[model samples]
Target: MVLTGWASMLAVFAVEFLSLLYLGTLQDEAVMGAVGFGSMTQFTITSVCIGVTVGGAALVSRALGAGNLLRARTLAGASLVLMAGAALGAAAVFLAAIAPFTAAIGLEPDVRAHLLSYVLITTPFAVVMGIGMMLSNLLRASGRGRQSMWVLLAGTATVAVLDPIVIFVLDAGMQGIAWAGGVGRLATVALGGWLVFGKHRLVDWPGRRALLADLAAIGKIALPAALTALATPAAVIFTVSTYATFGPSVMAGATVVDRVLQLAYSLYFVLPGAIGPILGQNLGAGQWDRVKQTVRLTSRWALLYGLGVATLLAVFAPRVADLFQVAGPGRDLIIFFCRYGSFAWALNSLFFVAIAVFNNLGYAAYSTMIGWLRATLGTLPFVWLGAHYGGAVGVLLGQTLGFALFSVIAIAVCSRVLRSPPTTDATARVA
Candidate 1:
């Protein structure tokens, strides 16, 4: 499950890095900042979609473990509808607010315009991509991790093939990247829909009442899960906005480091999704010991992976900075993160693993609380002080300190939860 999830996430990251690399070659800091702003904004909007999927996956996996195929199918179908609706709603809200939001951020005119264009072209496709994500998560919950991986790979492959043609050959710039992303999402929906609806028959349309009930149940988890997902992006958006004050060079460098972090630490990002089903199914089967064991093992693996990746990143930090053609303060930011800030990911991995446990084992509200605390108390003050003291380098160091502190808190809370008696009624616990 981990391997497949890693591959799927790798493909997604590869396409993103490719886009960033192409933009870097243009030697345009505004474009780089625009991409960073646009992508993070889109991610913020889509976090709700992810939360819904996480909620649905937890329910579906539990149902399947209990041998309740009919319930699983209904939940899957209803959840997809719910996810699409949420995506559409989020996109609408984003489009309406983005203009004013960008203005408020005080971005350079060119960067602001590019950011708007990127979101405008790509926002409408959120529904398509949300559906694709729903299907992929459903596939994983149904014990078809390989098919889920393929669903993601399909989108990645489409983007890989079209990005160069659209961006370079057609000279579409930011608009080209948006168009390719839209097309890639379409490809994902195509493959994912077939797998979930046609081949596996994993989802079945539910009646109105059933749909409402399932939605309500899913929302019990999704609401908190959504908040949990939103916390990081919200912190990141703030960080980016803060970084912008330092000048476009710093913002551009921060963007490069952001992409490198996502690519290198893709495992941590994918770990929650990969472990969700394991934890959910075990919980459903009343296998408390297995659930506990899975969390322990996952935590260990996350730490090991983090340490190894950090070492590699530090070793090759300079080459990576050059690869993005980032120079000046931006280059310094990248190198600084590679050498010092990268170690923070080791702790962040533990926090993420704890999140999976909370989401899957019916303690989702814990995830929300921890996530917000990290985003607010753990992030804002530290980042402000870091920037105030160390400039851009301080910012990275501060964020790292925040992660380390929060990871310890998360692990403590997670351990307490595990020691408590297990609950079979995930929804009831949430209520």
Candidate 2:
């Protein structure tokens, strides 16, 4: 499951890297900055959908483990509806508020225009992507990881094939990239819908009462999970707004490094999603020892993977900077991260693992609190200090140090949670 999940995430990141690479060839710093803003904003907005999937995956897996297929199906269908609603609502709110938000952040006019165009073209597709993501999570919860993997792989392939044609041949630029993403998401939704609703028959229409009950159950986890998911992007948005003070060059560099980090550590990023079902099912079955073992093994693997990737990133940092064509302060920032700051992710992976545990085991508020703590107290002061002391490089260093500190705290809390007696009620376990 981990390997397939990693591959699927890798494909997604590969497409992102390729898209950025193509854009870098244009040699427009403002355009790169716009990509940065657009991507982060999209992530922040879609986080609600991600949270819904967390809730869906946890409850649906538990339902299956408890031998309640009907409950699982109902939860799956309800989750999709909830996720779609959240996606559309988020996109609409963002579009309506983006002008003032961007103006408040003092984004440069050119980058702001590009950002608006990208968001306008892509926001409507959030529903498609959200529904597809819910189906993928449902598939995983139902032990169809391979099918979920295929759904993402198919979308990745579509983007890879269409990106250049739309961006270059059609001269669509940033908007073209947005269109490619929307079309790719459409492809995934089509495949995922077929697999979940047709082949697997894992989703079903829920009656009014069942729908309300499912929503209540899902909201318990999803609301906190959504807040938890929002924290990272919120932090990034703040960081990006701060970075804008430095220059477009710095934004461009930070953007490339962001893509590289996602691509390099795709395994760590996917670990939570991959292991979520395992943890949920085991907890549902009251297999406390197995759950503990899974946590231990996952932590070990995360550490190993993080260390190995950090080393590779350090070794090839310069080449990566060159490939992205980020020069001056931006280039320096990327190299510094590669050589030093990247190592922080080794510890940060622990934080990710701990979040998975909290979300799946009915301690979701813990995840939310931890996330916001890191985003605010853990992030803002350190980032300010780093930027004040070291400029763009310091910002990266500060963020790394803050995340490392929180990773330790998260793991400590996770240890205590695991030692507590397991919850007996299945619904309460998720609740």
Candidate 3:
């Protein structure tokens, strides 16, 4: 499971890093920033799908643990139905509102046009991602993590190969980048569908009543989880807006820093994902001690791994900065942010682990609160202060400090919650 989780994250890091690497080689920092905005536009919707992914995994794990395979299959089918419906709706809204949305965020005209093109090219197929999310989560929960990993890797590999051809050779520019990703996602949906529905036949269309019941079950868990997931993008929207105030170079630098962080902290982030099924099944089986042990051991591993990542980022800051071909203030800001924010990787790891535990244990609302705190209380004020006083560097400092503060608070809250008595089966059902 850990290997699969690691592979899944690695695929994303590879794709994004390659994209940024290619973009950087152009020596056009503004285009790089535009690319960043393109990514941010994509996240505006996919983050909402996190609820579906997390919910599907949690429910499926619990059902399987209780030997309710049939129920699990029904839930899987229902999730597909839900994802399709939601994806179509989201796509329509994004297509219609892209212009206004861009304006509301105060994007520069050139960047806004670039972002619009990217969103328009990719938004309609947003369901591909939601389907991929559902199928991958179901595969992981069913302990077919390796299979799921292969599906995503194949798709990401397709993107990696096509990215250069589409962007450089074909001269498609920013929009080409989105097309590359859409092709990759299309591949993921095809393969994932085969795995979930064709070869495995894991999903069976239950009657409408049964489907709706399962949808309700999924929604019960997914809504809060989705909100929790939504917090990051919402916060990113604010953070990016804050960075925009510093001008395009800073925005591009910050965008580069985000991609770097994703790469550096990929392993640490996977720890929480890898822990999800373990915690879910154990908690379902009433093995509280084992669940607690798993959290402890994996969290310790996350800390150690995070420290290693921090060390590498700090030590290799110059080399990493050079990879982006950024110069002037943009280059300096990227290096400074990487070194300064490296330690926050440890804090982020702790928070990820805690949130995973909370969601799997049916305290998703708690997870939501923690995420909100990290985004709002942890982020906004500090970012405001740092932007006001310290400029671009101060923004990084503020966000890092916010993570540091919330991580401790989240750890304490999760620890206390974990030690509390388990809920009764009836109470669990109501939740």
Candidate 4:
């Protein structure tokens, strides 16, 4: 799971970074703007893709828990349907508005045109990306989390090489990047599907009717989980708008910080994702005691995460900043502060254990609420204040404040719940 998170990010950074360099070479502000703005679209696709995948997880987990292997298999069939639907939607959106989205994000003209071209080219293949997501989740739920990671790695390698080759060397331009992305996605999805559906029959054979039932089941689970997945990206858009108040360097710095945060948060993301199936299996088997132990253990893990990661971020901020090679002293300094802010980044991960526990128990509302707070209330206003008051540094300071606020509130709420007596079916039955 962690590897997928990281590899997914590798594709992002490599592509975005390359786009920025290409923009510099072209000396086009619009091009830079296009890359920066296009990120929102990328994030949007990823969030939706994740939401769709989680729906699959929820379905498989529940059906498996029900001790109905037949239903579980049926749910698997529905997963393919969802994948097809997602692909169709993605392709439609990408085809229709890829260029416009870039323009809307305020990309400069030449860059916007370039980005639009690329997005359009790859839009049809977005379905392939969605398929890969579904396949990966299916594997994970079937107790093959390791297989999912390998498939992701393979895709990442393909994109890692192809992105630069197609865009930079081949001079296929922005469109080339899209083609690369599509190729990698297709290869990954094909390979993963072969293993799970054919080699292992890990889930049910996907039939039309079976898939429909799975969709209905998934909708119930997905709404909450999908909302949770969206929180960060929504916060990002808010952060972007707020950073605009301070100017591009600040916005760029914040974006850089966001990228850095994404890279590191893979560590935090790991336990929550991996532990979900563990919790699912145990919950299904009616091992309430195991669930209790796991939740407590996972929460502690979240608590410990901030201090450890934050320390590392503080220590390595400068070195990390240098890696991106953003131009200009001002840009470099902006990135420098972003790296330094890694301390706050680490501290902010406290909610991980809490979130992990919530997700494992299928407590989507609680998870989604916290996520919404962090992204919406927690991040946006503070970033606005930073830009309005202190500039870039203030932005980081505001982020710290937001994280501290959210974490304190979460821990307090969680503690209150923990202090309350545990509820069990047996207890209810006795009552």
TM-score of each model, paired residue for residue: 0.97, 0.98, 0.95, 0.82
lDDT (Cα, tens digit) per residue for candidate 2, span 1-431: 87888889999999999999988878988899889878887787778888998998888998999889988889988898889889889889888987799999888888888888878888888888888888888888899888899999888899999999977899778778888988999999899988987888998889999899999899899999999999998988888888888888998998987898889888887877889889989877879899899999999988998999999999998999999888999999889989998898679889989999999988898999999999998899999999999988889888889989998999999999998655655238593
lDDT of 4 by residue, 1-431 (tens): 43454455455455445544543454433444444545655565666666667667655765677677777777777766766776587557656765554345564445456556656666667777778877877777776767777666667678777866765678775566667767888788878888887887866555566556558666655656667777866776665555544444444455555555655555665555556666666767777677667767665665576566666766776665555444453255444454556556555555665665555554556778998998878988898787678766776677667866886676566555544333563122111
Model 2, residue 263: C-alpha shift (Å): 0.7
Q: List the residue pairs that clash in candidate 1.
A: none
Off by over 4 Å in 3: 425-431
- Native-vs-model 3 lDDT? 0.79
Could you tell me how far off, in angstroms, the CA of residue 92 lies in candidate 4 after the best superposition?
Answer: 4.2
Lowest summed lDDT over 10 consecutive residues: which window, candidate 4? 422-431
lDDT of candidate model 2 versus the reference: 0.88
On TM-score, who's better, 2 or 3? 2
Clashing pairs in 2: none
